[model samples]
Target chain A: MKKKVLLILLLLPLLSGCWDELYFKDLQIVTLVGIGGEKGDVTVHYSFPSVSGGNGVEYLTAKASGSSFSDARNNMNLKTGKVLDISQLQVLLLSDKSAEANIFDYLDSLYRTPRNRLSSHVALVKGELDAYMGNGKNENSGKTQDTPEFLTQLMDTIKEYSLSTDYNVQDMGSIMFAQGQDLALPLLKMSEESGQPELDGTALFNDFTYTGKSLDITESKMLNILQHNTGKFLRDTYIFEVQGREVPVTYEFIRSRKNWDIGETSITIRETIHVEIDEYSVTPVIGKGEFAELEKKLSAAIENDMQKTVESMQEAKSDAIGIGRRVRAFHHNLWEKGDWHDTFSELDIQVKVKVKVERTGILD
Target chain B: MKPVMAPVQMFLLLFLVQTGTFFINFPSLMIKAAGRDSWWLFFILGLLHFPHLWLFERFYRDFKWTKFISLLYGIYWFFAMVSITSYTVYTLNVYAFPKTPTVVVILLITLVLLSASTSKTSTSVNLGVLMLPLIGVFLIFLMMSINNLEWTNLFPVGHMTSKDLFRGFFAAQLPFGGMELYLLFRYLTAGKIGNAKLMIYSGIWLVFFMFMLILSLAFFSLKEFTMISEPIIYLLKSQEVTFAERLDLIFIYIWLAWSIISLCGIAFAIMRLMNIHRVKKPNYVAAFLCIPYIPLVWYTATKTGTELNGRILTYGHMVFAFILPLIVILFNRYKGRKEPAK
Candidate 1:
């Protein structure tokens, strides 16, 4: 009896292993998920890598519609043999039309689900998502292929260049729920020339609803710089008339800093950018005085463009730059007294820009 | 044989018991009560525990080891054991194994507790050594999360009213009831010193509590903190490393070691009360007493039961941890005056 008890005790550790453990091979790993359509009648798209004997890995897409996001996922699960696992999900795409109406209603499912990755990249899709998903050709090679790996690589390249904000689900959720702040997601559309998906600026959002306004690539880079989200690299081109010639000057951002001063009646935003001149179209022997002149013109031009962007954001009643959050942090009395959304629209604001050229790419 | 413990071992045991499972939901609860000023509320509550610990120490020294005092200590440990076991089981069921039956989880946890309880006090004290490295890893994780910290989230510090601060302090003080176990196990320690050791113990706990509160406030915005059920676990989840993903899983497993140590401490107190040392198979008696706790824990792990359990814990801590010890000290003083000196 003693030996029998010892044997059972010794075997208990092995029995303590997970009884309902799931294996990788038995799971249909969803890489990309897309949500579209109306609130009650929602459309969900799931894309996964399917393995076939001696045929290499094939990318498969499935669609399901139901009354809600979870119901839609459940409907999709009915069509697949394996369990749909979203732990490996890489990106979530939302259609522009549905996003403009109300994106939070679709995102509530992601926030509530414990298994969903909070860091999954979220983007806004322009045009019909069906057409974008159906395209099966590589833009550069003209090969018939539609895979998540390719899509992820494309967005990563865009992120590397600082054309779009690296807005993940957690970031979007934080901004949506947080007061005095809004969210911005990278926008993607099929390129007219290549018929492949490409980064199309950024989609601005007020609270949970998408504003019907977006910033172009230049404006987007400027906003990213002001928000201190200049990812790995940033490139900006300026066409300036240097000595009666339209000289195209390209600058590479090295670093930047933004400071805000909030007062009772007005706000001041100061941005200082340090850049290296990578390309200068003018072939003149530019001296120190000429370089200073070029620097002044560049700062003024950037200041004007940023001022216009801020005006547009204010016109849309979107505090995408988080000035309201700044006010709430420092100027509490103002935040408590007035409606920030309304205050943000008509509040006096100033923009100050200072540009410093660190190095001129092995040339004067 | 009576098991002996060093001062360091006693301190570590008390620290683990006081910090168990409470740190999981503390940030969320604190934020709900005090908003952005949760860190201040935590600081005040930590300071408040010093007097309570001092009073309890005084009571323990004056009373020595009486049957009546042991009975009260046993009741306190009994409630603590059930609460901690139920909380640990609930956490495991929700986060680690969603599909596992609650009964199986409870039984497994109880088995681990029994094994640790039947061992010598020195063996449990050696297990307490694991807490040193656990604290080291927790601090390292906190430092690594500095990239996500937003200093502005801690602004507007004096926004909460006195009433709100009082409520937050009371809510924060619920977990410190674990310190009451010190009264039961004071005999195991080598020295019968003054309140110096109590001060040191309270100091260590206060520093740890303040660190957790401040880090949580700095890492998450007020609105974001309120949305999360367990801010510490979520904070761990946000930390991404190149070598491993899901650091939260690793954190939960390590935290389980501390939970088990706390459970062992509580079970040991109960065993002492029942005079299990008199029996040949004391481990059997300890295991039997823990069986009825499993179903009780299961019942209290539900939503409504958890709320009711919190209310019971609040009032119970006030009575058994504070009021009872103060009354006993006063009664002993009165008796000393009436009986005169020898």
Candidate 2:
């Protein structure tokens, strides 16, 4: 009994949790961080929940500027009453100006800090970060859903709609460093009408820096399809010409299989998509032959649009489809030729999309 | 002394002692050395352990523990334990407790080692059995990172140069460092556990390592293998479970506990050696053995210390664990035993 008691006494100090023990009250959790400006001059916006006058918690946005992100964060720490902790940070917004610079440089501090969360959502914002991340009085400032929660939910909603790939801050490192593949982040712009941040398009990046080119929402959806990044609901409306009249056909994607055939200098990407017809306004008495003809027309239209999407990406010099990755793995001779971005821009790449309408909703 | 430990317990000891400290950084080293071809090299190197085990098993009965051989093993295990404890402290400081002093971390680890070393060898052997279920849980959680794996990263397999192959083989030696313990134990009776059982046990251990290697390779990009020092921890850090946000913290603590136990296993071996040499009060001697290591371990908590420790472990493992044992076995097999003490 004496030995047991002595052992307990010996272990009592260890139970105090030592020097790194951080109390919750001492830490002000910053849920959202916005980074802007170029390498030498950087600005960071930290948004944290603050308790006010016996009421519920209200979020407050604080801004700081310095030479680098760490410098800005350190400067911000001086202004805050409590230690500014980003361990629970939900989203990181990068401005267009910042995204134009080397992305890895902006993110290196976050990655190096062991306490920083890597699963946070990263998005590219249009214009200055100050406009999007206002003083948190969003309701009075003619803004709707400008909060970080809304932004994260918007990104999640887009992911469900198959408009963007589910690449977080951690996953971006893989794509950023990979020689064969490039990274495409979701682009956000404050809606002029709603004064809320909206999914503008997808930002195209060549190597580590932004290529100053982006694809619109429709084109971004197409890019997601080509990359096989289909989420739960991949619904799209396509214009089909039937009997000299253009009719809109809406389809929900079921499954897709992509096969890439690479030659010496040319590559052909063939995709077979199984879809369910959600909406077809013009209901012609379709037989099996007519249905086959419809499939052929749809395939040709999708193929043309997909080909245009590939051209746009190639023009931007962004291999977001990981075609270069496939080539590097299988075709070593071509991979060793030159820089992947340069080789990708010059390659003869073709897209062939085949759509098979498995179901035509409940009406059919 | 009679062999009190069961054959199963001894095998568990061997596996835990060889791999506990190694699993933290072995994947990164292997991937950095060989890239996509790391898994292939690991397979070949893992298979090579069988021949060495066979050689040890054949000559082990004839081999006798002399004062010189015992002293060499004692010194090697002592330094090995110190190095491993230092590395573990370094890891804990980086991930779990950034503000904790290296000496404090060393103190806590050495306290556990001191306790285990002062006890019977069976006490340390039984600790391995209790960890089996947790190891299974750890493995399943590691597999949860499969959702993040990019299967295409495993391609370009045959691109490793001769230099890379040589480096990969050298890096692969980290896990198999203390494998000479298989002969040292002698408690795993030859009658119950033959060559086949030993091979199967080793194969299971190798498969566990290969699974971790494959997950790490496919999970991170080739360039990331160079940047991230602890790919396994980062892999776990990137993963999110339903209940926990930071899975790496839980696993790191578990890994730290396993490391301490493995250190205890090493200390137990040194204690057994001392006791065999008829040293007075072997337990107290083993306890005193850890006192000097605190300062040494604290000094080696830096990056340079980490690199120095790595080189020592690699070369020391090659010379002391493999080459020396093989030479001693060969000498005993061909020329017969110089010191016939049993």
Candidate 3:
């Protein structure tokens, strides 16, 4: 009798057929999700692949407008036969218009759901969502490649080139709630030349809202270097006037380091970059003294650019460089005295840059 | 009547028990209380466990008062066992199996506890031996997560004020409460001197605690650490390895195994205190002891239940694990001196 009972208990799990189990075939895997519109009436775009057996995967896009994100998601469920599974969601796109207002309100659903992928890449779209999604389709083929996959690959390639920092949902959450740091997301725009979406630069955030200001690609690279987020190589080309002629030199970053010194009334940020000469339009037989002068000019230009970036960020009240975090960590009293955002805007901040030409590309 | 463990087994058992459910959310709780100084608070409170170990060891050496001390320990074990089991069940429900009914999870855990507790003590020690590899896997996962660590997160070490440090110490003491199981199982190390074994075990515990605390603090910023419910699991989530994805799910299964071993240890302690080991049907007695815990476990797995559990652990550990042990040692010493004169 006991043996029989044990057998029955063993078979019970199989008999249940996993009532709570979620099967892949029964789930609509959302690859990309876009949030737009204003606070009360938000529009969400879910881009997924419509797979039919024996046929090629076709990209399908859906839209739902509701009072809240969850409501919009539920409304989307009414339009689909399978449950919307965001566990495999790859990219989250927030339109620039909605992002300028407040993104945290729309992102609450993702944050509250335990199963949502926190590692999903988050990007800021520069223009209308409809236009970007529409242009995302191939013109002649009449079939669209997956938007999220395309965007993800584009961002990955850009990240390898050290163009912008890869900000994910988890990083966004951390920066959003973090006291001393603001958020920075990759800015995506439709390329006028190719009519394809391309990473333009970085979108800055103050608190939970976009600051309506962004850094250009060069300034973005400089900011990344100061934040110690540079990839294997960062290419920078600068123009300097030497001997009454415009000299263009390109430097590939070999390595970089940054240090911060916090004081009572001021903060000093020092950056050092080691570069190998990739291209130099100047004469190869330039003297050593001339090279030193070139290096000084390059350092000053980089410092001036970084100083402007920091000043712009301060004007926007965005501390994406985490100067406030450093102050909170090392200067707790100053952090506790008043609002960090206010103090950061008015504080004496200094930027110093040093460039070392480690290799001259066999030109000596 | 005889010691069941060699000195080494005693150490392993103590280590396993103390580490129960600590890998779950202890770091978050500490960060919530003391901010960036949570790791320092963890170190300070972990050192405080040594005196409590000494008191328990001193109290256990007097065989004349063994029964009374065993009774107090048994009662303490009952609460400690409930807390540990409930925490494991709550975490499993929250993280792994949210849809499964609370009763079913509790019953399944209780069934495992019954089978393990009814068996000989060596069975559980062998289970502890199996845990060595699991612990190694956990440490490896923690090591892999170092690439994502921001070491500056642990700065401004003494930023927490005295009151905040005090609160953090109390919160950190909850995980160390499981170390008190050593008193209940002291018979296992009967022939061994207490000091060396105690120091070795406490030292090992201290090392593991420091490793986990430092890793957690470095893995997330103070604000992020405070906001997260389980910083260690989230830390593992941040670790994207080539071989395995979603390491947190895999790590939780290993954690569940460790929790089972810990639960079995607690169950056996309860059985020993109840004289279930001497019964003809010890398995039945073990099962019976688990009955009252089912509803209690169900309660603790709820939202309000966890809050009450935290409060109980904060105050209860200080009294039962710390203060009460000190009082018992002092009283035993006085009684021992007076009895000889009488």
User: What fraction of the correct interface contacts does each predicted structure contain?
Assistant: 0.33, 0.74, 0.28
Q: iRMS values in order, in angstroms?
A: 1.8, 1.0, 2.3
**Residue lDDT tens for model 3, B234-330:** 7777666667646777888899889889877777677766662355565676667677888888787765677677778667767766676567667
- Residue pairs with backbone atoms closer than 3 Å in model 2 (clashes): none
lDDT of 2 by residue, B1-342 (tens): 456677777778888888797787889999999999999889988888777777676667665677898898888888888789888988899999989877777887887888877876668778887678889888888888876778888888898899999999989988888877766686333345578977887788789789888888888899998789898899888886678868889989989888887887788788878777789988778767767888889988776787689879889888876778777877876876643323
- List where candidate 2 sits over 4 angstroms from the true fold: A15-17, A53-55, A136-146, A243-245, A283-289, B187-192, B338-342
Runs off by more than 4 Å, candidate 3: A1-11, A14-20, A52-55, A134-137, A241-247, A281-290, A361-364, B63-72, B157-162, B194-196, B275-280, B337-342
TM-score of 2: 0.96
Quality class of the docking in candidate 2, CAPRI style: medium
**Candidate 2 chain A: minimum summed lDDT over ten consecutive residues — where?**
A136-145
| Poorest lDDT segment (10 consecutive residues) of candidate 2 chain B | B184-193
Give each prediction's DockQ, rounded to 2 decimals.
0.52, 0.78, 0.45
TM-score per model over all chains:
0.93, 0.96, 0.92
lDDT of 1 by residue, A221-273 (tens): 87788777778899988899877888888889999788888888888889888
Q: Comparing candidate 1 with candidate 2, which one achieves the higher DockQ?
A: 2
Show the lowest summed lDDT stretch of 10 residues, model 3 chain A. A130-139
